[model samples]
Target: MINTGKQAQLAQLKDSNAQLLKRLTARESRLNRIGMGIDAASQEAFEAFADGINGIAQGVEKTLRNERDAEAEKLTNEATAARRSSTHTSSDTAIADIMQDVKGCIEEQYLAAEKNLQVLASILGFFVDVDAVLAGCISVKDTQIFIRRSILAELSAFDCIFAAYNKIPNGSQIAVQTAHSRNGVPRDYVEDHYTQRTTKGGLLISEACIIHDEAHGMDHAPGIYTDEQISKWKTIVDAVHARGGLFFNQIIALGRVADPNFLDAQLKGPSNDVYRDREVKEMSVDDIHRFVQHFKQAAVNAMHGASFDGVEIHGANGYLIDQFIQKQTNKRTDEYSAETLKLPKEILDAVVQAIGASKTGVRMSPFSAWQGMRGDYDPVDQFEPWVRHIVSTYKDLAYVHFVDPLAGSSQEDFRKSDYLKKIVRDAGITVVSNSDLTLEMANERASKYGEAVAFGKLFISNPDLPARARNGWPLNEDYDRTSFYGGTEKGYTDYPFYK
Candidate 1:
């Protein structure tokens, strides 16, 4: 009897356990289904909203263009009548009034467009996929057309069209010549594209002043340290700063230090093949010190003269410093070996020692593959050492901006967000995050991180992004794809603004 009771109890317990497991599995499946449904609904709603706004924008754009044409025709007719009548005395007053009216109309139109843009931007701000709408392979001109067609006129006046066009290259043509070869491009081309297009007013708060890589200018021969090159950079920085705009100063190339010899060899290599011709050679501590000294002096000079508001160390994008930090790249057997890699600390120390810690910022693409970068070892191992270095040595630096490796490319190599957040929090340093973030996403991340978030594309379209973001306004879509690199007025200055 006792054996039978024990067996029966055991059987009952097993059955109960099985039933519980089944119930739990069913609950989880239901939850997952609910989540998927929510996501699908959100996507549908966003698409609908975008389509509606775009339709309104197109109509408003058409109306404005027609109105402008009509006004121009009326003015032309009045001018012809004045010429035919030979009534100089009365005609002058009438003509002056007409001119004033035309000016008023232009101003009104500009205001209307600007207002509509802001409102549309605000609506789009609620959606998290603004990056798809704003960045990536799409052309700015196409984006502008999309915005003009989608958003309503009431919201059109709030767009960033005025801001976007102001940054386009104008007047200057891209001339290919030998004189500009010092900067890689022909002298005439440089003069045509850079000199003729840029203006003092335009330089102030222009979108290009923020998003374009500072290193693009460093492509000039003999590197950025040359007197002439440094002088030109100073002029550009000063001009932008004078206009109350922020200029990001590109510091030393981080990965180059891992093999300074390789850099030298590449620079000295055949003129036609520079970026990929030579293999990386080993670098010594002395080499790093020398490079740091040169960069420090340049930064100090720029800062002293109020050339830029701040300087960002190009520590990210698999550059010299990152190369050393990454295990696969830094195969040095000496004290700089992976086990005892102290190069990051040394580099940080040199920079912090030279530039005041408060004025310095470091950019890190912890998992980014830009510039042919591949973090060969486990990302955690590659990143932990650098994070440890940052906590210990450069704690007082302004902020650490991390370029999320998962962004802008199709790669699933790294997804350690939780780990990164924990480390950053423990380190207690201000962290600014970037990578595939839309305005809405950035704001959300900022809310969670309690620090600023950087937006490359939004900054490209909206010169006054900070202000627009704060006011819940719409942003103008970038319209000109071709002009983004080198062009003038058609895509640059033609975007109208709100009054």
Candidate 2:
């Protein structure tokens, strides 16, 4: 009986243990279901959150797309209107069509500018002045010359040799002014004296070659205008004036501050050194002041005898004034520091004081690296300060001339031109824009900013550029590049007229 009772107790204990194991397994299965439900809910929440974010992003993108489309449509309408209103002849239209190969070139420039505007808007918002931000394009040497020649060709197509000051009798010889002496004591009855003589019939001055150096030397090749050559130039000036043409003085290559040897050491390249060394330094504030005074006197003299409206200092073409004003080239520790630096203020102040504010004008080449100039500074760093300085200091200047960077170069670095233009316009000055601008491009640029645009090469070939542009005539190509400098007629007088 005792053994049987012990076996029953053991069985009861085993059953109880089995029951506990089953309960534990059921609890674990319930806990797993609860965990799975929580995980599913979290994943669903995440998916919904991601979907909402994507929706908002899509809306913003649509809004931007709509805005861009509207802007593009507006631009397209303006461009179309410009094309339709242009009074081009059938032949001109044909030529323009042929020139369509260059349309992409033109459009590239336009698009680059548009993109720059977008970036500026994003950074500064739409409230900024677009005009002030879009200063006119910079002028290039090739483009300027092309425009100049084109204008000349169109205007003076009939003249075989359209010489401005063409003739002066025996202009090659020098003449002296002398006074008669009274005879007296046996020592010396007649007073004998001699002096260096001035050329008879005034000097024939054509293009003004403004040298930027310590000594203000004339850079025109020797035979172009000797004391003898002056007579012929004077005649040309007089004749042109008589014909209602205005004679202006352009200062060329007038910005060598230091001695050539010094510049050679600091700057690179032998060609640069040669030019710099040859440059007699006449670009200091004091020197520029004196030069302006001389110019004033010369202008008065020229006006007294011939037709003269006014005088313009050749502040363009990377001359001394431009070098000093630009930040990259002007590494001076003295008063003429970078535009951001305060030194230029004193130098500019002196210039303003010396040359009357009304008579003076400053020219800058922010993007141009002409004559080995490397404006390595940030474009804004280089331009903003300079523009600000000009605006604040020389408020009365006639105008500011900006030489736009070359087209190919600008394409390589699109931001350069835009940055420069923005700085200039923001400064609040009348800007004369120049570049390799075709007639259409020039007109578009001018229309955009209401600024005067100068076409160098076109001006050269078509002297009547203004009229040709107005009439929409086809421009004559420049045939002789060699005759561009120090030559008599091949490129200068050979182009024929449309009529």
Candidate 3:
């Protein structure tokens, strides 16, 4: 009589478990209905979706746990009865099947939720209206409520919320040109293209413009101190301005990397370390003063003569400025020590003073030791402090361009770009992301980080990169590596305009 009672209870538990599964299935259906016509594109939408998922996930887990407990009880009773009867009939397979189904269902739901989040993030990148949706959002919970309300309200103006919070102008979204040369100035190499009509006309299709001007220390390159160099740059600047494009002149001062043969007899850096064939001389106070003067003069030259929209201080990519910034090369006890940041501070101050704060920008490659500039300490520990210091000091500058950490050998696990952004977001300066970025990446990153994108090689082969990106046209990947530097019209001006 006891065995009969136990079997009857086990049967009731199975029936109850089946009803639970049916209810879970119905809950999933209801959740799906809630998600209908709801796509998360911005931070607001994403948070809303995450909140909904979390609540539903908790409910599902609770339901599954109850079902599992009842199932376990049924199995235990069956096993006890089997042992007493000495029949040794096994219901182990059926119990195992029930457990497996529950596990699979939970796993599937979690995976589906993850996939949905990814889809929403991608959609947010390409299609969200930033103005309408992102406006006046105070908190994550509030944002969630807004997303739900927006859907139910059928707000027609909701399209405004999807606009990327981009500070850059529309036509000049992609900058093809970069600071890759010291010997060849864009003005001299591509003279014909710098005419007012040609430039303005071409810029109608182009996005942002980065004029890779000469690094300051190289004698072969145009130095801002000279009248001749200023004249050439002026011509290009006026033309680009006429076209209504934002033109930035990249000015660099190669410190340790300055070739002794090409620059001073003995190259100067923060340390006395030997690089390649030359032993770098540590800069004295006098040297720092002289360098700062040159930087200031260069800014004065570029600003006064060419009327450039802005000047990008080339402080990255293993250049002289980078040597002073990195600990490996910058091991001095003076004010210019790796910890002090006095050298870059003075140089930046001089440049900013010469050119107003609104027209001065700084570019840094914190995660890159490119051109044999390996720092002695961890890149993160070394750069994080400096970023905080610089943002505090020069909060009003135009922008801070950081070469993407993913592009270099410094560190991959840490996103130095995002880290810097977190520190500088409230500082009121734009952060530009550069190094090996394509059109799709530019758009995605701009949407994700709310920053501008700088292109290097893509701009080299395709002059009309902005138009190509907009129209989804095929780009010319063919670029002559041999004729990249110090070349005539062969590789410079010879790249045909898009037909």
Question: Which lDDT values do the candidates have, in the order given?
Answer: 0.45, 0.39, 0.54
lDDT tens string, model 3, 1-499?
A: 1233334434553444344345434533433443323333443444544543453355355546645675677778777888899666466675666556655665565555445444543543222222222221221111121222121111111111110111111111112343323333334433433331132212111211222222234433444455655676677667665543445566677777766545523577778878887787887788778777877777777778766555777788888778888887888877778888787888888888888665677778777767777555667677777678777887556667777766443444245557776575545455666666666667776555445556655665666665566567888888767755543455555566676
Candidate 1 per-residue lDDT over residues 1-499, each given as its tens digit: 1223324433553444344335434533432332211134433443443343343334334444544565566667777886899644454454455446544654454454334434444433221223332222321112321111111111111221111112224322223333333231112222222222222222111121111112222222222344444455556555443433344454555343223221223321101112455444455566556555655665664455435434566666666666666665666667766556465566566656766664566667766666655535666767776777676675556556677766554344435744664566455455656665666776665545444455554444454554566587777656456765454444433433422
Alpha-carbon RMSD of each model: 23.0, 31.4, 21.4
lDDT of each residue in 1-499, candidate 2, tens digit only: 1223324433553443344335434533432332211134333432442333233334333433443454455456656766899743343343344335333433444345445444433332112222332222211110111011011111111111111211111111222211111110111100000000001111112334222222232222112212233334345455544333434333333345333331222322111234544533223445445544444444433333322222344444455555655654565555445443443344445444644454344455666677546546555566666677666766445456666777777464447665555555554444556667677766665545534465555555664555556677877656345555533434444445554
Q: What number of backbone clashes does candidate 3 have, counting pairs of residues 3 or more apart or in separate chains?
A: 15
Which window of ten consecutive residues has the lowest lDDT sum in model 1? 147-156
* Displacement of the residue 483 alpha carbon in candidate 3, Å: 1.7
Q: Judging by TM-score, tell me the better candidate of 1 and 2.
A: 1
lDDT of 1 at 446: 50
Highest lDDT among the candidates is held by which one? 3
In model 2, the runs with Cα more than 4 Å from the true position are: 1-206, 211-238, 252-307, 339-356, 411-419, 422-428
- Clashes (backbone N, CA, C under 3 Å), per candidate, total 54, 66, 15
Q: lDDT for model 2, on a 0 to 1 scale?
A: 0.39
Which stretches in model 3 have alpha-carbon errors above 4 Å? 1-187, 192-219, 406-414
